[model samples]
Target: MSSAFRNRRIPTILVALAAISAFCVGCSDSEDESDSTTTTTTRSAEGADALTPFVGTVHFPPVPFAGSDGKNHLVYELSVTNFTSGKTTLDSLQVIDADSGAVIDDLDAAEAHQRLQPAGSRDSADSLEAGESGTIFLHVTLDESVAVPKNVVHKVTTTAEAAPPDLRTSTAEVGPTKIDSRTLPVLSSPLRGERFIAADGCCDASRHTRAILPVNGQTFVAQRYAIDYEQADDQLRIFTGEPTDPKSYFIFGEDVLAAADGTVVGTRNDLPEQVPGTFPSGISLDAADGNYVVLDIGNGFFINYAHMQPGSVRVKLGDKVSTGDVLGLVGNTGNSVAPHLHFHVMDGPSPLASQGLPYLNDKFSITGQVASTADFDRSEGTGIPLVTVPGLQTTEHSDQLVMDQNIVTFG
Candidate 1:
């Protein structure tokens, strides 16, 4: 899949190619009775009063992520909405390669206008106005000696002064996608030998660790690989005496295990805990995941466990839990700012309405690296050190794939 985007044709005014060939024959007749490995294909071009304007989807991440530097990355997401009542301008988005159509990477219009969303403040309007929705956070690394692009192609393009028709283009078709990785366990380290801090791992352009969450009305971007786990030390200090004492921080209650072998499907113990350096007022999104736990752990995955520890939740809702079993401790409650854990792996059990897949951890080691937690929180408030790196560093990350700040340890 690399013939560099063959025969590019861009011009359309009132598209319908037999309604896009009956929407690709009803997506190949429900993808042959659907077993679901995640494949999606779409293409559109409308204007002459039929109106569509832009409309996008992309997703893709069933496999491909061998990267700890060995390459093969992939990671997708395009979203796009703008449905025309007025403003529209995306004008470029590429990614192609669906069997030799090549192109591989292109999203740039000021980083797609800073990854649009809510579009109400950076002085608004980077185009998408009418219905307004935006995501574009792709990745694509490939080349660990080749052979990974089974299917892909997201090629979008737009422009609209009320559909004047200067360019339309749409493409879609995401993948043969299937990289189901989920080997859990090693979950017993909400903090053990000490220094921790992966603060927003996996694809974090920080829309609060990957955004676009709507839920009931649907929109979903569900954390897309969430991971916040915090606690720091060996000089990369996180907090000490009186920051509203959630035990002055060093990972307040700790524990939190059960990274696999599950069945609990939901539990949310009382909810209170939240003081360490503040933040958590008027919270509600059904308590924004404060004292949580979700588990299921079967094929369609489900392992949530966010901001735990109010009563330290043991396991309930159906109770079957195994691998390192403990299930609860670490706290600062919902939408926290301190005692961290907030792990993720979802497809459902409703932790913010699911969909954040990708899991691996069968082992971990990489011992030193705080690189800059805002220069270790300004060297723990001005003792002035900057890039601390304490000791013990072997970097043993097998079947590895954990991003953001990474300073692992677990067995």
Candidate 2:
């Protein structure tokens, strides 16, 4: 529950006056009485005249996951739009435990600015203009031992010039509504006997693939647990000799395989690969995903393998593919910075227009990890000695989620 006062008593005289005004408006002869009556009733019931200044929706996976860090993680986003006629300031937003009314997390103005999507960040004004909408990313991690909340609340505060500060709040019921966890296919390394670094995997804070994309007039919160895999040598070098040549990287043209038994639902293999060191200018949405494949792994789950080489896809739509089946060859296409495989699991066949769900791998050996991209880049560009920490020596991960920067080899 929100601490702010939300329900104010309406004076009897004002109610009577409003009713009389509605009656007068209804009797105008040009307007329908039913329309006038319904409008008045709706306004009074919702207190629309005493506007909240903001309106929006929030979404999250129903079943939360205990991530690699051993914490129950909740990833959600709030799409907020200013409804007030004038500019309004969004002071703060908070995630609250509905049952105990405990404040779970609070996002102040500066923190909110940092979480806003790219379009929202472009606004130079401090206040949101009327009808302007923005998205706020919220990631909450709780003790793994604690039970996940069945319901959550969102409390927001905003202010306008003449009106009193409004405390607008909403509640949503959450449960294990997401797809049930299944044993992910023990996907063989797309590149056999070669070590690859997990650039962004599972639930990492710096993983922008987890960001919500507002597409086709719909709020698509997909790619929440996507992974970007790049090949790295023993020295942690991503590229050798010539940096501009795609062939210089070890991952280019590597065989891509099906992670599980599934039917191919979609694929694109006509897009040309971009130059190794530079991103293509003015990339369109359809071309952004690059050459890709969407496989239906049954039970409403779809696996996406993206950035495959042109003219290399061996499977077609509706083709049944088995685990480890050669589907295509990896290439730099779409919105790729270089040659890498972008993999993720979603609920829909439409690659970018679905909800991303968490998945677990059967087994893999963790060899090492790169601390940061800066270190990885320096090692690749300047040949500086890269520091590598020995991981869980040849250990097998059973039904465990992969983490960021993990250099792993599949059994």
Candidate 3:
């Protein structure tokens, strides 16, 4: 009986100790035993018979904001470390879902090793120099339909192309789910820096862009004659410089606000702003639409506000914005002759497919004259002759000029 009792007590004590160790010390590798048996097997299979093993890790950044599609997508960043004696290259990467074990994403470096995929699995076709490393990025959508348990396991696999080609794999588990929300401005300044026109033609036909004026008192002109945009960045820009005047130099940098709520789907911020100029020395960055912002407004529709000021952008890379949120001030940044706000709508993420969508100004004042939407384009639209308030205000009829260009010309 004593022996039997001791046997039972031994198992009970071991179980208790294991439980305590798990709770107190946590689970981590405590030994550095080189499993030569496994190593040899893997080496023989990879044909690297002489090459050693390299290990690395992958991580992802948080999502910028929720999309109008009601789906939350996050960008993943992956890093790899090489421990060999020479350099190597990787061809591709793949990510597998933890719950379903399904492949989530894949990335591959293409010709000249330009494109790099996000974390998860990588190709074994590329060579990795000993002690060399690489990184990549990918976009992944979160699964919202499933209920996850405490700790879920995920698997990652990588394939490489090297002197001794072999397959590399890794696995990790995801903890609980958490959602975070933060707010920031959406629109951005138009004038980025000094840029040259990449192509010719109007908005959709050209590859570059232009800027617009946010304040009144700036004079803008149409492309006088289909002129070449080459060497336009070196031209001199005209500005009104008068916050209250309607006839002045162009406004390049002003405060811009968000038109709606949405996450930043795409952004290109490093473009140089074009200098103001006329024929002979035209603006270089001349493109139709000009410097602008494209905001996703849900239901496959994106609103674009173009032709903005330079060096006026305030938002960072990833930020969420609300309606009427300040994005940046308007100015002539791209293929613009004068300062003007160019608005349009598009179907896809690109502005090239954007169609001229009609938008109603919540309220605005017309100081000089009023022109119908149709007649506005003929003579740049007639100016509003009335002072706009909640209701209306009486205006003096002393001004007799045709207020074209939808502006309220003040004298």
- On lDDT, the candidate that comes out on top is 2
Query: How high a TM-score does candidate 1 get?
Result: 0.31
For residues 1-411, what per-residue lDDT tens digits would candidate 1 score against the true structure? 322224232112223332333334334445442332112112332111123466666554544556444466666566667765567776556676667767666766665555544422323235677667766666666677666766665656566555333224333332223333444333333345555666657663354444656668675555766777766666656666777767767777888888778799788889888875557789988777799888887877787878887888988899998778788888888878667787877678887766776666656676666565566455434333336455645577766556666666776
Measured with C-alpha atoms, the lDDT of residue 367 in candidate 1 is 68
lDDT of each: 0.61, 0.65, 0.35
Candidates ranked, most accurate by TM-score first: 2, 3, 1
How accurate locally is residue 176 in candidate 3, as Cα lDDT from 0 to 100?
19
Please count the clashing residue pairs in each candidate, in the order shown: 4, 0, 90
- The positional error of residue 393 in candidate 1, measured at the CA in angstroms, is 17
Per-residue CA lDDT of model 3 for 1-411, tens digit only, reads 344346544333333332333233322553322433234323322223222233544332222223222333443234456543444455444444444555544444452133242222243225445556544333444455532221222222233222232123211221112222223123222112221111222221211111111113421112200112111112222232442232343333434556567555544344344444321134443354445566776656555666555555555445776766766656555655444445443444555433222122222333222223233222211221222123334233221211122222112
- Candidate 2's TM-score: 0.74
lDDT of 2 by residue, 315-380 (tens): 999999988888999898988877889888888898778988766665666777677766665654
TM-score of each: 0.31, 0.74, 0.32
Q: Which regions in candidate 2 have their CA more than 4 angstroms from the true location?
A: 1-51, 59-63, 118-127, 159-162, 165-194, 202-207, 373-396
Residue 235, candidate 3: Cα error in Å is 27
